[model samples]
Target chain A: MLGLSKKDTTFLLVVIFLTLATPILLQPFPESSALAQFNAGYPDLMQRFAIFGIFAIGFNILFGLTGYLSFGHAAFLGVGSYSVVWMYKLLNYNVVPGLVLAIIMSGLFALFIGYISLRRSGIYFSILTLAFAQMSFNLAYSVLTPLTNGETGLQVYNNDPQVLMSEGSPTSPHFFGIVMNEATKVDVGGWQFTFSNGYYFCAIIAIIVFYLSLRIFRSPFGIMLRAIKTNQTRMNYTGLNPRPYTLAAFVISGMYAGLAGGLLAAMDPLAGAERMQWTASGEVVLMTILGGAGTLMGPVLGAGFIKYFENIFSKINDNILHSWFSALPDGLEDFVVFVFHPFIGKGWNLTLGLLFMLVVIFLPGGLIEGGTRIWNAITGKNRKKKREDAAHHPKPTSHVN
Target chain B: MGILEVSNVNKRFGGLQALGNVNLDIAKGTVHAIIGPNGAGKSTLLNCLIGKLIPDTGTVMFNGISVLGRKPYEINQLGISRVFQTPEIFGNLTVFENMLIPCFAKRDGSFRMHALESIAAERDIIEKAEHMLAEVNMSDKRHMTASSLSRGDKRRLEMAMCLVQEPKLLLLDEPTAGMARADTNNTIDLLNQIHDSREITMVIIEHDMHVVFSLAKRITVLAQGTPLVEDTPDNIKGHPKVKEAYLGEAAA
Candidate 1:
């Protein structure tokens, strides 16, 4: 309906609905239930879901569409965060300027990095990006201490002049008068739902960027990107230069990462050097691959899945484990808890690693492929039945002929 | 005067002289064939024409402009399209997508940012791509992945991809290298039909004499990095230099 085909329109609508209704959907368990710990309706975690979704969606444009595995997206993310915090320090706590500057700064950084990194393809390209990201990380931590504030991170202080701030303005990060931390909590019997302003703000931006990515996926530019991924030799002979196209994609994805970083600081007025670490860069890669690299919904799904597990699964401490298995026989309960100990709580990485391995081995196309397979299996039988029925009762046109 | 002019082209690879002082002129709107036994520098000469190789000392010109040292895309932007020995279509994309890329390249030079516009909105490009696919008889397989197609179908799709751009000059490197007899005949017929239908110039490199005799208007026989003779296909059949190039000196 929005210049998209009927199928793509429907997919986009579904994504929008899911993003908007995440708070209610995530809080499926009631407060009194034993599984209450699994509920992710809280503001902080939900903000992360939307923020990382933007990051992964952008990363997918490069890594997914062009097959350019960038190990340095986290640097853009950090740049975005620092830009927002700098805006807060110089101007007011309003996120708009910071977010705009974040996109511009990250895009500039991406243009510089992408111009050089895109000269080589495949492993060399990946290593070059990795090197650039690490350099940014080290600079932020040590060399750029004057700007980054070194290990202490960049946060607003009382003495710093917020020139835009007035007597009536909100003290913390906000979109104009609307405070990001403000939430309305509702209680219905044992169930509670918290609708946070920050989550919705991130959700709206996430939806917009997601739609943009979807358009890119179906555009002629997207086709060129895929052609680059498949065969550059043919692309050159077809009169298409792969270099400029790849550079554009790199910059675009970098802008996306920067926007995501801006959103991170908007929710909490803090910019940490740790955000640009290699591990942070690696996380986005995992999210894209785990969910589905090229599919429209895969990166978002992957981002949500990893964030949910990271938050809920890591909170499963020994006490919770003991309480869940307390009803069992004493000896058997201890043994069960012991067996599951390494896979939960502090050992969540082990579980994540094992899941990543399984996804790679059995479902190389990622979670989206698995979903498509299951969907096909359900509808395939009905299609076969319909075909048999049609065979049994041939059309009257055949008899007339 | 001809559309393509190659003069005094010399190429050396370390101790080996791949191409040695070669020269040729290819007329417009004609099917010219370059034929030789293995290692006779047929491929090397074709590479020089398409900017894949830079000859040590030579001038390769298309229409009045020199083509030496230009990038492959730049060479193509000057209205020259190349079909590789093995069909070099984007194997990961659909046959229809394969056609759209060349059409986009033709319409929008080398690079463009049409990221926001939907593919369906490009009505003229779509219509042209569809028309080309229909002309190649690959409309039914348009949605099929390019890699899944049979070898003959893949070759046809690759040709369609090139033809959709409507290049003034078309270069084919071994158009039928390892095809079955039936598929080879089909490809020959397709090439003949394409040549008859368009004002395009074609330069084909072939080891198969049957294909050369059927399609080529003029034939150039190369033996050991130099052209032995350039004549009509009928004259080339009786040329003893051509016989020696293919069957060796003992047979001649």
Candidate 2:
């Protein structure tokens, strides 16, 4: 309850509504709407959003709460994806089996890497993680080619067995026991909206995972993790050995990443070594930092923001810009095109880099700050009423030990 | 077997000796106070016992088993708990949550890697934490964040944290080192009450003379790196050698 007040609960509900509804709201807009062309309600993009959202949130568990910056979180995610692909190749093409395999593999990998890397924390820890991630990437690209398919990655082919599901070869049909088709569409008032059955499936998984993470943040272990961030020596003197607790936290976060990775593969039966790249791992780090490291919903918001922009910004071209800017004066069109050309085309990465820097500087708390500010603005006028209620509320028992 | 025993312990940092040939034996359910000057090895001795530091030569035995080469958690599992000079409660945790962690330790032992279970539903742990909080008079502040507590209250919460584990021996380093005179007295009273009520052996490192005299049935005085003398409070207070070597020497 220390972390989850009544206000926070309300805030969480709002976030859940927004994320679940965003795809539908963004999908059906007429072409004239400002957000119509920029929308990423497409199956491929939305699935990526939910997957990376989970990844960023998982990384936040260690870095945000414990003040540990791990450069090798990508290793666990990569291991998870590879393990999931193997499960698909060996067992039935069921999402459930894939998920279990991913989690178990990622947890074990984290245990091994975390054991060694935890030996030296701070900068050394970061370096160790980076080294391990690179080692894993290299192995996936070379020695583990049979399983990982080397640089090209493992893709589902006609010869591959499709045991569990009918339509999606190598990807089992139902998710979390839900009939995917039933969960993906809704019809009302002469309007019909259909998203990828897989997208909604991952969305539900993301919600449940997010809830579990929230519970973790409010638990006793969560408290100790925060203490470790503040004063590890103090916790030790209080009869705690932080190493085990920290390791446990690390493993749990890794499992979450594994879950996300398996979901990624399940949504598309394709395992690419490129997804395991250090850059991909670093992407989640940027998302977590850009959104605000420690806040619960920051990662999700950060992930969505980055993914949406990455999808839209890269689609822009000189032709698209010129068509829109044709309505402008001829003289200013050249000046506008000069500035927009780089960002609208191959220079999307620069836009992301600049946005990340600006967010980290201006809104260090990320989307959570916006949420808090909105809450204050809405509730500020009712402060006296709230306090009055608080005063009359049942006092926590005053009995001394 | 002595419940807790330290034999001929020696510790050196560079050329400086922090503890030299020190020996101690503690039985169950007794309060033992360790008094010393600034450069005395009271803290160092404790650190070695808890496996935070390894002495140059010594073996620490807990309940007939040797405890050297084990981590602090391993030692804690053997029922040896420590409290620092500064209260070390998890600042973000509520007082009740601070109690819950040790209860988890007590119920699960040194390590139980059960990844997913409702820990509160653990009946034994719940009872123990509730009981310990009651013992320390902190049940009311159970839901208050540990960081929000006053200095004395923080110390109280830390003590509750250790008590829930039900250790055979509790090592406290300068429990009353920084406090108002009144708070210090309250802490002394609290310790006396806990020591009286529980079957726990205590080795407290205290700079406060009043606190030491109030609870230590047997006081061991140390100066530089050697034990000055081990005796009752009356004898320790009167001993000329102890006064010149520690009390007077330290204050000067």
Candidate 3:
């Protein structure tokens, strides 16, 4: 079963099926309906979802298994994007070399950062990683303007030497002869579904990365990482070095972020310094935690949830709210829209923050735990005891003995 | 020559001397106990031996290898396993998973990348872990999380974790520190059985006299920051120096 156990193989299959069917599933609203505005099946948004999903999945490998919460993972993402754009500038529009260079460069960056950051654990480790990322972000913004192109971002110019580019090939990123942005729209009845080449490409890579993550989670290396999370002292005393294992996990996770960043650049041939900002890093963390940090499907779900809300929720204006409540009394509808004003439209981030807090407070295991709880309740199983035990043991606490 | 040899070890914390000019030789395949009152440098000496703390001026030789500046994991790879005063099992993992960790370390050295191999396919390691759990009478609780176990059971699991490595030297720091009398006796019996069945050596630091006499063949008593006496358990039982150091009685 692809080197996975029976249960893991089944889980991977379900993930593959769902990812492949995302465009169809996400476009349930008919084109004529008002809810159609909420649909997320558009090519641009779908590509963003898949790319961020890859980022969240990679972050989970470190934070979920080893309990090493890296606060600077976005630096790798930015580095990856820069590498891909550079590849486009120097090589060709083909994404293979760009992606390969992105992964290699980010892996080396992760190795250097991980080597230094892993010397400390807990919050200090987080601070060290954050500092490194901030330094990178600042450097890319100002000092390394020639390399990163300062505020304008790094992109392929018309005059740049692309040695590998054939004379008649498209200047934009492509997979051989197929342009990444090419999309096909099929209209059935009132429903319109968009199938984008870029989204499909990102989705396929995301599925492969997700499957590899499943293998890593079930492997002996995954067990060792969990062991390090639970009791690092015991790990050391048990004849295992936690440092090298943690460093490896960190590097692998960084490569995942780099792959995501490369995919983003492939879809849009630009690399922004803002992508390396701490806020971008925080978004991935929020996604992983909101969806469930340790669980396999949590991060991707979290990524989709956040991205979907960012697209749909931000579109809600007072006028749209009024239109939805038009059937109600005029005064009541006005009051209703006023009441909802702070949580919708430009305030969508406020709504997201509130939801994130609720998840952290009530459902510490993220959305996955909430789903499990509901399932257990419906099945009439007394899972309270088990849930209590898990809550009692939260994350591993450090102690000197 | 003994399996572990410590000589002229001195350690200080600020103005207070934690360990002063300590020397010891632990013979192979024997149970040696190091006992002392509160703050008598018993733990400091143990720390020095296990690479947790480096003595100011001393030499620690394990199987003739100088263990001066080695990391804890490196020291563990040299076949010396230490059980902490508090049970330090992987709380988030199952008892069976906890057992498999040490077995893997023993088989695959300190670190190996097996990220794609399934645990179920490792038939030999799984069987070995299960057998070790049965020996510790924890086979029924193998699937239970380590943190959910009772205190005494956690101690047993920790012992099983250390034993799975099959180390040359086993260090126990207060193995029965907070156990009931019955549990203490059970631990003593378990230690005695393990000692009789294997060629392993043990050095335990304990406050329990009953545990000290039951399992320790050789005893080293420390007072202040240095070893006061080293002798057999019987000779150490009623030594006048030990009584005075313990009871603060003036020598008569």
Point to the candidate with the largest TM-score. 1
- List model 3 lDDT by residue over B1-252, tens digit each: 999999999999999999899999999999999999999999989999999888999899999999889999899999999988889999989989999999999999889989888888999999999999999999998888889888889999999999988999999999999899999999999999999999689999999999999999999999999999999999988899999888888761
- Name the runs in model 3 displaced over 4 angstroms: A383-401, B250-252
For candidate 3, the per-residue lDDT at A72 reads: 99
TM-score of chain B as predicted in candidate 3: 0.98
- Please write out the lDDT profile of model 3 over residues A1-401, one tens digit for every residue: 88887887888888888888888999999999999998898999999999999999999999999999999999999999999999999999999899999999999999999999999998999899999999999999999999999999999888999998887988789988788999899998999999988989999999999988988988889999999888989999998989889999999999999999999999999999999999999899999999998889999989999998999999999999999999999889999999999999999999999999898888888898889889898986866676766754445332110
Candidate 2 lDDT tens digits, A124-212: 98899899888988888899898788988886655766555455442343554554333355555544456677777788788777877
Deviation (Å) of A308 in candidate 2: 1.0
Model number with the top DockQ: 3
> DockQ rank, highest first?
3, 1, 2
> Candidate 2, residue A393: CA error in Å?
22
Tens-digit lDDT string for candidate 1 (A111-142): 99999999998889889999999999999999
Ten contiguous residues minimizing lDDT sum, candidate 3 chain A: A392-401
Candidate 2 ranges with C-alpha deviation above 4 Å = A1-22, A64-67, A83-100, A157-192, A218-245, A317-344, A381-401, B1-3, B119-143, B247-252
TM-score-wise, the better of 1 and 2 is: 1
Q: Could you give the fnat of all candidates in order?
A: 0.91, 0.12, 0.82
